[model samples]
Target: MDPTDTAVMIENYEAFRSEISLSKEDVIRELFRQNQDRISIKKEATAVRNLIRIIDSTLRLANSKGFHAMTLRDLCADSGLSMGGLYAYIRNKDDLIHLIQNHGFIITRRTLLHYTRDVPDVRDRLYAAIKAHLYLSELMRAWFYFSYMEAKSLPPQEKRDAVAIEREIEAIFLGVIEAGIDAGVYQPRNARLVSSMIKALLQDWYLKRRKYLDQNVPVDDYAMFVRDVVESYLLQA
Candidate 1:
């Protein structure tokens, strides 16, 4: 795709990038807020800072090794926290898994809705959702990688929750496409399948990131390509 062809896409993507932060500290701060009752820490600032260390270290350790193979001791050593301190935030690996999954899901849902909702043009809204997801995944690649790789080994309920999160994200795209069709902005098509396909394309960016990186694919370029392909399929000639 030509850079000029995606000028609006680049603009929306840059807007999303500037307006939202997926920094570890910001994510952990929100995580701390949601899990304050479970976490023993009382000081927000201190908890946020340490939670950043703990979560970042967890992602690093889990991705380097597997989440199942990683131990609390490993986490403690990696995070520079005592076993007792780790326990203050999580009761066990199960708790930690839930925290990590919920943290990503919460931010993802929020980010998608923030970028897409209230946009009057259905085409722009769909493109916004696509770019927003791609941009956020690029920002939180480690968390995205860990979440996908570790979902199967999660305890049964956690596994179910993970599937639900994936479906909800797919549903967000489905909603946008369905709205576009209803609004007559796009030709009639299978919105659900299209949404799932868009998700698979998005996953290709994050899950096979090394392949793309080695191939010299920038995320913005990939995002515009996806938007172009999806629009070509959906738009009336």
Candidate 2:
């Protein structure tokens, strides 16, 4: 995008943030639905409510006490599910890790693509990308926080896929930058590097959320800050 061809401030997050795009209950149900074949106790464990209970408990525990250190017993206790019930959904911690990662990827990738696809202006698309990511992270705080904090704790193959998930995420932004460049709207630069930089800035929202929360900074405010900084940098000659 030619930075000069498009210069717009993003004032509305509704275009990027939607309540109906995906729901928590749907996410929980999807997890159980997709992995039911792998789950041995699937027949008796088809309750969406119970499945959600397990997922909620797992993420809460993982966020509080590191995904690596949290035990099945601990998850059961926090989630109010018996160890037997827990085993029905997951074979072990690694499976739990993959499950949470799955939730994060499904919601984030879908939301990002859904919101940005309709935006024609590279500036708006870039702006929507930044805001969409931040809002999604804000909405999926537990999963996003847990995913960022414990990505390395994942087992070998899951860890690699996790990293690739992050890259694909950044590629969403990279695609926008390349689009801008192709259209002669954005000033030329290393689009990949710029995309990574944007990812870094957006990641700070969830990584350092407490700092922003302590200062009473809202998601929209931070999104605007990052969007402005990124647009200015890209617009620079």
What's the residue-level lDDT of 180 in candidate 2? 96
Top TM-score prediction, candidate number: 1
Model 2: lDDT to the true structure: 0.77
The best candidate by lDDT is 1
How far out, in Å, is residue 154 in model 2?
A: 0.9
Q: State the lDDT of candidate 1 residue by residue for 101-215, as single tens digits.
A: 8778877876776667677778788878888889999888899999888876888987998889889989989998998889888899999999989999999999999999899
Candidate 1 TM-score versus the reference: 0.89
Off by over 4 Å in 1: 1-15, 22-27
Q: lDDT values of the candidates?
A: 0.82, 0.77
Tell me the tens digit of each residue's lDDT in model 2 across 1-237: 112233333355564345534366676666677777767655533656777777788888878887778888988888888888777777888788777788777667766776677577889898888877888777777888887777666789878988888989899999999999999888998999999999998888888988998999878788889988988888887
- Among residues 3 or more apart in sequence or in different chains, the pairs in candidate 2 whose N, CA or C atoms overlap within 3 Å are 1-180, 1-181, 1-185, 1-186, 2-184, 2-185, 2-186, 3-185, 3-186
Return the clash pairs for model 1, or none. Answer: none
Off by over 4 Å in 2: 1-22, 41-45
